[model samples]
Target: MDPKPVNHAAWINSLGMSFAEVPVGTGSILVAREETQERHLALFRRSRNQPFSHAARPATQVSWTEAVAFCDWLTQRERAAGGLSFRQRYRLPSDHEWSCAAGIGHLESATRRPEEKSNRLPGHYPWGRAWPPPQDAGNLCGEESAGDFPDNFIAGYQDAWSGGEVHARASGPNPYGLYDLGGNVWEWCQDRYREDKDWRVLRGGSWKSARRETLLTSHRTHDPENYRSDSVGFRCVLAEE
Candidate 1:
């Protein structure tokens, strides 16, 4: 089947960015412009939900307010450094926008159905069929520290599924060259939880996830501002200047 070429959203490519715009989806995607995936390691030191359960809490967890602050910092930093215009903005993808780009539900042949295109790209997770196939991809912090498992890596797991390295291996990069969009860590989104008053939305299942569907790009988890877990972290993106 010939993969249908996808079109950029009218808002993303044409209208450009309107900071206060409610966004096409109720969230923003954290986009990465470079291969280094920058400052993500700093997310683990967020200092947002401290006094949290270290056993389960990820250091990168932050409140909606904090997320907004981080976004603001990106714009201010870029502008001040003369690298980008102050008018430019960076933020997390709305739940809708994130899913659209997650490449989950997306199949090029499908008529731009939001559900189909999200998972269009193929891989053991995102990178490259579990790095070297059979082997797990990258290391997952929430699973067992940073480097606990050896044989269960991307080069070895191949297709054995479950209990592996929580989807490690550099092979699991997403279609955008983004790594671990499926597992490793459940990424934070811009929405407050749907039901509860919690102020955090989580996409992408964590190392703790067992179901394939849960690991899907569209599955979402909600969390309260006071709660933090090692399973949660985030990526970031900037709007075109």
Candidate 2:
């Protein structure tokens, strides 16, 4: 079945979420330009006291289960409203899809699950291969972050935001026009960390990450599916079934 044409502007205004098309292998998927915000999450789930009180901040302290539930809720709501076709739905991007959106899709691994591909592009970062990072290179832990995370922060790197704060769309978009691919908050992916583990994968660094090892685009991390943290959040992908 053919998919309906999407009115990007109208969708953004109505849903408060914008997406960017990203090519993967033989097909493409629409990736949310920014992480899911608190305002959006509140539409489906009850409001809770979040560390960042701003409506535009990434919705953190969300478990993978909650995130999946949100995607299901959004799919139902949009389909009911005739905004999405039967074959179209919202879900978290897979680890490989996340890498493609982050502009590091070229690095392939021999592992069966693409999520296991890590540390392939050494010395390279989301903002290009440079030491100490450049200005406006997403919301990473820097000197200003020291006040909150006394020991975990880049020594000299700094961005516009202060006090290790996380703000959605605060940093410049990546080459794919996707924002916060490297920082602001760690984003959840659909795949498990490994075939033998039940842990789900997470990509992108967070405002609390300071080490070069963690900031690399090839870096991969995981947590139990039910785990939640102030630094972990997720973005959604719109694709055909």
Candidate 3:
């Protein structure tokens, strides 16, 4: 079935979030154009440490459980406001859905849940396979961040931002037009890192990520459900209920 039409402007105005429809298999899902900002979270009585206090900056120090709660809050808020159809809801994207957003869905593992597929395409950074990364690739640990992360910033890499700042939409969006899929903040996914482990999955790289391995589109990481950090945040996806 065709995806239902969404009033993108209304969503942004009411929720302080924007959505972009990204194709997934036979249907599509509306992904938040950027990471959830502090202002949006504050609307739901959720607040995180704001190093920059910029309302547009990505909300950080947010735990996985909190991210899920935000999704649930958004789902209910929209449903009650008549903005969402009964069959639709907000959620964290699955690992596979995130890969699709990153334009790497083709490398998905055949047998593993999308959350378990890791390091499938090695040596591939978000901005193609090139080394040292191109200018404006993302908000990675770069020369400008050396002062704060003396031992962690990339040796020669630099971007427009400074001091490891997590600017919302600072980096360009992926092919799917979803921002911060590479760097800015690590996003929480719906699945656990593995079936046996209780840890949840985190995708995309964060502003603190300096190593090449972590920036690859296929790279996956995990943390406890209650873990929170200044460099970690999440995006939301609107999908069929």
Candidate 4:
């Protein structure tokens, strides 16, 4: 059976999550847009160097624990409001799920390669595999970023943002109807980054990411669960059972 698309206004206006239904299962949900500062402020939290600018930018510098707590609070709030049934819950997407939504696993299947499993997991850059990321590809480090971190910023790319401009959510959606899957702020995934389990995996590179290597859809990094930075934030998922 085919999955259904989420009602855009419903999720954004109600939960502020802005969900997109992944093309798998009975419409597994992925937040279509990163949570913005205006949205997070409703939760009563502040990003790094609070009030640096307007509230339209993506919320950044949030700890994994705080992101998790937001999920918990949201779940409880929805349940209490009778918006969520007992079987439905909001939480962070697992590493595998994050990959699936990014379309990383199915990258080469379109070529009809025998080894390319249609059921393969995860995918890459929201705009696809072309180099020099197309205009509006995402909010990655650009000319201004080069001014601050010239050594790492992608050469010959100027994404319009200034050195001090706060990054915001993309104005459009990805091929999968998702946004900012390549660059913006790094998104927290549910998996423990290592055997020690002290850190959590972060997918999708941040505005500070300059190299194409770091912005690859499958690229991953980690930070301590309690650590927060201007480049880190997260989205939540709601699996409907």
Q: What are the models' TM-scores?
A: 0.55, 0.88, 0.88, 0.79
Model 2 worst lDDT window (10 residues) = 1-10
lDDT of candidates 1 onward, in order: 0.45, 0.81, 0.79, 0.65
Best by TM-score: 2
Model 1 Cα displacement at 43 (Å)?
Answer: 11
RMSD of 4: 5.8
Where is model 1 more than 4 Å wrong at Cα?
Answer: 1-30, 33-64, 105-171
Q: Model 2: residues >4 Å from true position, as ranges?
A: 1-13, 47-54, 109-111, 162-164
For candidate 1, write residues 1-241 as lDDT tens digits: 2112232322321112212222223333335422112233243334444343323212245554555565666566567777666656777655555554555433333234333333445442432233332234433322243254443333223332334333333334444444556555666666655444665677766555544345444456667655555556554556654
User: What does the lDDT read for residue 235 in candidate 1?
Assistant: 48
Model 4 pairs whose backbones collide: 61-229, 103-122, 103-123, 104-122, 104-123, 105-121, 105-122, 105-123
User: How close is each model in CA RMSD to the real structure?
Assistant: 9.2, 4.8, 4.3, 5.8
CA RMSD (A), model 3: 4.3
Q: Where does model 4 exceed 4 Å of error?
A: 1-10, 25-27, 44-54, 107-124
Candidate 3 structure quality by residue, lDDT tens digits, 122-143:
8777777777877768888888
> Which of the numbered candidates is closest to the native, going by highest lDDT?
2
| Candidate 3 residue runs with Cα over 4 Å from true position | 1-13, 46-54, 114-116
Error of 2 at 151 (Å): 3.0
Report the lDDT tens digits of candidate 4 across residue range 75-133.
77788988888787777887767766766533433223212222233324556656777
